[model samples]
Target: MGLSDGFARPLPTLVFAVAAALSMAGLELAVKQIALGTAYAVWVGIGAALTVGWAMATGVEPASPLKLLFIAGIVGCAAGLKLLPSGGSAAED
Candidate 1:
């Protein structure tokens, strides 16, 4: 569901509401075990990409070359976030 009509309609509203709640719980759990930046990046990036994919699959939105490229970009950014080194430097004795 798109932002404007996510909860404006009845059926989709319930579905989206449940999905959002689940996503929040997952984010909370992830933050406890990983860096906040990493967790947040993964959360938002994956969520957005999945939402786009779902929309396209359901015919709610049309799939175009540019949209596919954007999906790729989002996944790439999430990967980059996971690969980046944390700020903590190695301690020397």
Candidate 2:
């Protein structure tokens, strides 16, 4: 599907995207402030729980071990991003 299919009007799409980003960023900061270690783990666990909930809500079958592993990879990357020193940046992987 194309972007046009998703948005009959641009304003609603932009508004929704901003709202979603703000909410998720708040969650991330809350998790970070609660102690990054425990917070990060809780964030990963919460992410997995949310993915499972999303699949069920959308009537998708529970994925297999390989798929779960791939999902874990993504969560791991997010965790890795948090682990980098506050001012640290990277070039290419």
Candidate 3:
């Protein structure tokens, strides 16, 4: 969304670039402490849930009970992933 909105706007483009860079950096740091698959799933799940939530909040998308339920499910799954063992010791980080 940010990237699409940025197509002819300077500020939005810059913001999108910075946000993408930061997201990647955070993902890189996360993989150091967790399994790659778990980290990636949590990262993508949170990002998707938040994006949809924001759209609903700002009225860019219509809000519905089903949407909210799915968002909760996504959040729950991400949290569950975090709770699972990573098959590595914390000291490995």
Candidate 4:
């Protein structure tokens, strides 16, 4: 029960880090397609929802109120992104 023996005596966390890096490629492609405004919004929303879904899908936990709350926050972020001024506007600021 120590901090340095999680995976065979400090077996590197490199695998996880590498996966994270590769994952970014797909993420970046998705974001680039639908435009940062919409793509990012959808990505965040989907990510949150899917995370909970995956947890449940794997029999970790059942759906709950907290999941609904995250969805709401996702919606709010989408709306805010839309309402906010997008960069590279024609008018000087």
Best by TM-score: 3
Per-residue lDDT for 3-72 in model 3, tens only?
A: 4563677777777778789889988988998889999998999889988987899888999999899999
- lDDT value for candidate 1? 0.85
**Order of quality (TM-score):** 3, 1, 4, 2
TM-score of each: 0.71, 0.41, 0.81, 0.44
Q: List the residue pairs that clash in candidate 1.
A: none
lDDT of 2 by residue, 1-93 (tens): 133348776876786677568657867796655556656665666567555756756667566778667767777776676565553345432
lDDT of 1 by residue, 1-93 (tens): 465384688777888788989999999997886799799999999999998898899899999999999999999998777766666643531
TM-score quality measure for candidate 1: 0.71
Q: How accurate locally is residue 28 in candidate 3, as Cα lDDT from 0 to 100?
A: 94
Each model's backbone clash number = 0, 0, 0, 0
RMSD of 4: 6.6
- 1-93 in candidate 4: lDDT tens per residue? 122356454334555455457556656886654457666666666666666676778778777788768767876786565555456553654
